[model samples]
Target: MSFYKKDNSDYLEQAFYSLQGQTLPADEIILIQDGQVGADLENIVKKWSQRLPIRLFVNRENIGLGMSLKKGLELCSYEFVARMDSDDICHPERFEHQYNFLKSHPEIAVVGSWIAEFSETIEKISNYRKLPSDSEELFFFAKKRCPLNHPTVMYRKSDINKVGSYFNFRFQQDYHLWGRLLNSGFRIANIPKSLVYMRVDERLFNRRGGIRYFQIETQVQKTFLDIGFINKLEFIRNYIIRGCIRLIPNSLRKNFYETFLR
Candidate 1:
């Protein structure tokens, strides 16, 4: 998991607590300290070290999500690596289900579950996001969109490395990786269970908008086209749709997303 300066101390503790309470306990909690997150957060990490088997790595300079994850993967000891957000809450049975599933289906390279998006607190779940269960369907879905919930995924490290790991995409790095994995014939699936409670708010829509994200959307669409994951028609259609979405008002975009897209 990766955390930066903006992550809250209480939320970080809650996240660690959730990991600590997992039914199938984690072998090692590989926490990436993305740049300097201050002394208070360090104290939180130090406190959790005694309870959770944390493998902490500190980054002297902030490298963002893609590079940070790439750096973290090299430090991982196990074959299967589960992705967790520093502030999100994972259900106690999440790792148990994903681990068992991966063990049983050795051919599948990645597995992710649905997520309940909450605002304020986990109990205040405001939205839900679900993905296809079948590998073929999910692969087709990846041609136009991200195939998995980033934080809810458990992926094979070797498979991820084979596809060049996580590239330095400023935005939607997981989407780009999923596109590459699917294009390379790596299988993936979803459990159809909401195993993670992801925190989000209206600010999410704001982040998705603005000039930077709009530019990032264009770059992502172009990346997919260059990778052969999407054809000319899909490239044009996706770029236009995402650009318009980014250009729209945040409240309107959120309503449109929750109403039709989600």
Candidate 2:
């Protein structure tokens, strides 16, 4: 997992505590410090390092999520890597379930699960993101949206590397990665249960809009078209749909996410 300057110390502690509570605990937990995440978080990381099997890697400068994950992926010494966000809470059986699923289904390279979205507390989950149940549905669903919940995923390191791993997409890095994975014939699936409580608020909706974000979204769509994941017509449709969603007022965009995307 990767953390930045804005991550809450208490949340980071809770996230790590969840990992510690896992039934199938991680062999090596890679915690990448994206830039300088301040002293309070650093102290928490240092404390957890002594408690959990955390292998810490510090970045001298702030490098965004994609590059930070790329670094973390390189540092990971295991075959399968489960991803967790520093501010999110995981169910105790998440790792065990995903690990077993991977072992039983060798054809599937990435396995994710539903995520419960909470605002301030994990206790009061406000929304749940239920994804397509199998790889076939997930591949088709990728034409318009991200098929898997990013924070709820455990993927194979070798497969992720084979597809060129993560890239530098600022707004929708996971979506872009899914496109390439699906296009390259790698299979992905989602367990039909929620395994993570993802923190979300108005900012989550706000972060997905605006002119610059729309430009990046367009670029991602173009990349999809070039990769043969989507044809020219579907690309135009996605552009129009995304344009409406991204260029709209923030309140309307929030409603769009709530009414449809979630």
Candidate 3:
């Protein structure tokens, strides 16, 4: 996994601790400092490396998360790659469960699990679970919005390479990448289990983030249209639904999403 740090060193440490307690730990942990300069982060890195094989990648200038992930993937020596954000915590059996599933089932190129949301207080924000398991169900949902949780996904290195690396400098690289992967005839499957804790709030969808998401959604819709993933009438339905959701008040939007999108 690749981690980028800033003043959120505390949460970063917590994320690492969660990793340390994993039932099946990663062979290597790649930590990237995306131009975050602080004594706290350095100390945390030093402290964690004593027990785990942590490789540190430092950026002289700030690069976006997409670039950070690409860099991490470039340096990864493993066949199966899993993603974990700096603020999220993975379940103790996350890697073990995903690895075992992938090992037993060779057809799925990418796999993600259900996710739960948490606030800064660590309280459950609300319901945030999804239940589309195979490619057909996942594509059914993806036609409308991102059905995969970015941080809870694991992909085979060869499959990612076949599709191409994460989009460079894009606003919603994960969302766009999923679209392209589906477009290319790859299969996606869900583990049917909650495996990670995600943090969500108003800041996650402020003006800038809102605009970014809209751009991604538009691009995804266009891609869907291009490949006949959905008819014009269905596209119109999804476009209006997504547009209206984007316009709702942030609090109401969160509730609407938890109720309907999942």
Candidate 4:
């Protein structure tokens, strides 16, 4: 699944190229237009539709990522759905590796992989986002941070729907959905190796701070608490630590992620 909101001609093209390069190609690509987009983006999609089985869905109004993804999930024809970002590049063997894992581990409902984050180019990888590989470790990790890389995940459609699907949250949609899945007794795991290259720049770091983001973080934490995924003490501790992390400089924030969260 992929979603786009504006004119991202260059990045979108690279994303599609990565998909086309995959050794185990996708059966169908579900592209969601979250809102009004440029003609250039439409043309790019049209150009790729000729080569791949691309199913496009347009949302007249901007409904945000959660609702947009929920719409995409409803249109998926396969049992397994792989999530992809409009700006990231997946490894050539990403699908093959993930598909084999899920097929062998029938009990696992979701599988994700580590990602190498870069600034301008894939060769200049800045850092890696490493995650736990087992459900027990993932459940413990989820109380404090997101246990899975959202864009690198391949999940069972039936399991996600059984756990109430994606919710319409501003900044924490993936995080919230993972919590719900864990509570519903679905197992989650991650591959130790990197399966995708994630794009990160100044804008990505800058988005982590500010009062508005804090409010959204607090709201998400409350939801987790109410759902019994987190207790009162854990919620308060998370809020304080995360609020402090947000208040720091972007450089320090990046370091915090690498030093503590990763």
User: Model 4, range 1-262, lDDT digits (tens) per residue?
Assistant: 5466563788888999999999999999999988888788888899999988899999988898899899999899999999998988999999999999999999999999999999889999989999889889999899999899999999999999998899988778999999989987889999999999998877776788777788888888998999899999999999999899888888888777778765
Q: Which residues of candidate 2, in runs, are more than 4 Å off?
A: none
Q: What lDDT score goes with residue 239 in model 3?
A: 76
Q: In angstroms, give how far residue 163 of model 3 lies from its true place.
A: 1.0
lDDT of each: 0.90, 0.92, 0.79, 0.89
Model 2 TM-score relative to the real fold: 0.98
> How close is each model in CA RMSD to the real structure?
1.0, 0.9, 2.4, 1.3
Task: Pick the lDDT winner.
Answer: 2
Error of model 4, residue 149, in angstroms? 0.4
lDDT of 1: 0.90
Better of 3 and 4 by TM-score: 4
Residue pairs whose backbone atoms clash in candidate 3: none
Ranking by TM-score, best first?
2, 1, 4, 3
RMSD over all Cα atoms, model 3 = 2.4
User: What is the alpha-carbon RMSD of candidate 2 to the true structure?
Assistant: 0.9
Which segments of candidate 3 are over 4 A away from where they belong?
5-7, 120-125, 169-171, 205-209, 227-231
lDDT of 1 by residue, 1-262 (tens): 9999888998999999999899999999888989998788999999999999998998998899999999898899999999998889999999999999999999999999999998788888888898899998998888777889999999999999999999888768888888888889899999999999988877777888878987877787887788888999998889888888889999999998899767
